[model samples]
Target: MSIFHLMLSSVVIFFVLYAPQPLLAQFAQLYATSPANTGLLMSVTMLPLAIAPICYGLFLANYSKLKLLKVAMMLLALCSVLITLQQRFELFLLLRFIEGLILPAALTAMTSYIGQTWQGQCLRRNMTWYVGSTILGGFLGRALAANFATWWNWESFYIFNAALLILISLRIKLPPLENITTPKACSPKDYLRPLKQPSLLRLYCAVFCMFFCFSALLNYLPFILSNEYNLKDPKLIGWVYGGYLVGALLSMCAPYLTKLHNNNWVILTAVFGVYCVSISAMQWQNLGAFIVLFTLFCACMFIIHASAAPLANEISSAHASITNGAYVSFYYSGGALGSFLPGFIYQTAGIEMFLLSLLLICILGAYFTWLNYRIGSETQLGR
Candidate 1:
């Protein structure tokens, strides 16, 4: 039952995360706006994603995780239906922003539930399914948009997602809630202490940098492919995104990799190498080479995300929820920046220069990762 609930929760998240991509083109057409403005559609949702986790972490800390999750999923379903009916861009944005608040709450609840219910190999396996569900959601959402658009309309995509949510809600039996104090009941000063740790600070920075790279690529890749390469087929774009499958695989393998050596160093080296290779690969105009490079980029991204999430929690120890919230806020805040910054870079500088800038950020990320590793080792050894 726990596994079923978890899978259902993952599907909900998958739609939440990936459903917006195909809709970007649709948003552009519906609003008669530029790609840059359509990009803001995603930014609007991400803004709340950046803010809500912290607020929820601090304020709703004692709420029943299962109850909140179930309610959030229902709210998400309602929001999706409402969003589907909207013709005005501003209205759609408003719905998305509200949905964003619901999403982080759901995420927090889900994480807490997983922590409470599972441990060791079970926990790791569940997390792998979670990550895979995210990628699968991305693929399924895009593929549906691409193939089904001709039969129905863009709004049909939301309808489909809503149906799926409803089904999950009906079938899943979430675990009973345990009695606990809400994080909100804690003083503001209590939340601030996690930032004092150098190791935690480094992890926060690393998450920010990693998301900056991943989000930039995700936001701009479609535009680059469509405008520069003149690829118009949405199906093809979905195929390109299929590279995320490699990411799902790599994320599942992360535990094994960690057993082999220092997970931090392995992730740092992979991130740095991926950034350098991606920048070079972006120069190639050929479709085949583009796919290969993008796949490699996606793989590296999953490794970073898979490793960083747990590391952030590990560093926070007693304050895992607050630290996790801080980590998420910084991560998505970087994503919001990445969404818009790449457009500005593309306008002012060439694509290669934009890629180069991301490479530099990746290098900084590597440095921070190493710093965190050394600090963590010292702390452990001292104990």
Candidate 2:
């Protein structure tokens, strides 16, 4: 039940955060706004996510993390309810900002909870599932939201997720765990602690590149599919997002992948290679091929991310939650960048150039991973 609760929260976070992605073009049209402005709807959720974790980790460090998680969950639910019912666009964005602030608390607490409860390989395996649930949640949220909106109304996904979160929050009972160290108080030093490690810093850089490319690509995909292939209906576009399920499936294999190679660098290089290949393939303009390659791209992304999170956990000697929060800050900063930056590129250059941009990111990510491995000479990870 504990693991179930953690995984459920993982799903809830991604589902709530990304449910609007596939509908960017729809929002653009509905509001008569530009793609960049519509993109901000997604950016607003992600930006607060990237920034809030630092504050949460810094200020709330000494508190009961589980209780904190529950409070954050309840607040997120309230924000979602307001977002679901609000007819005004400005009001909806305001509610989403509040939801963003609440998410990091929930996530940081969960990280702290996991580090306290589990050990060694057992922890790695569990974290893999938690990561996989996040991937699945991300996939389901966007895919289901688009389809739900098509079937009924645009707000259906928000309403359903809001109701689900309330039930989930009520049922989660945080248990006392051994070996977990909660900080006594927040300080500038505590916030900066994770930054002092060389390898960890390298890993954070890699995460930034990873999400930057990944989010940018996924956020604009609907527009590419719609403009190039004339897939305007939300239902049809939602099917492409099934690619995220492919990512979720592969994410579950992170532990196994680690055992085979026993090195995260190898895994990282291999996945980024696949990412470059798949991204380059996007320029071909074949819908079937695009979807398949996009699936591979998202899959590779989750695999690398799942593999990397454990490394962050292993390397952070203390304050695992703070380190995790730092990693998430970088991770989502990449995401927030990707969410809105591609609009100008797509507007001026076209989908082909935009994909090429991702291709460049894949190369840079691979380089950073290889550099980190060489410099840190870290042990065979995920052992």
Q: Which candidate should be chosen as best, given lDDT against the real structure?
A: 2
**Residue pair clashes in candidate 2:** none
Candidate 2 stretches greater than 4 Å from native: 20-39, 84-87, 143-159, 175-186, 228-235, 378-383
lDDT of each: 0.70, 0.76
For candidate 2, write residues 101-149 as lDDT tens digits.
7788887777766765677777778788888888778778877888898
| TM, every model | 0.87, 0.87
Query: What digit string (tens of lDDT, one per residue) describes model 1 on residues 108-170?
Result: 666655544555546555655665666666667666765667688877877888888878876
Please give the lDDT score for candidate 1. 0.70
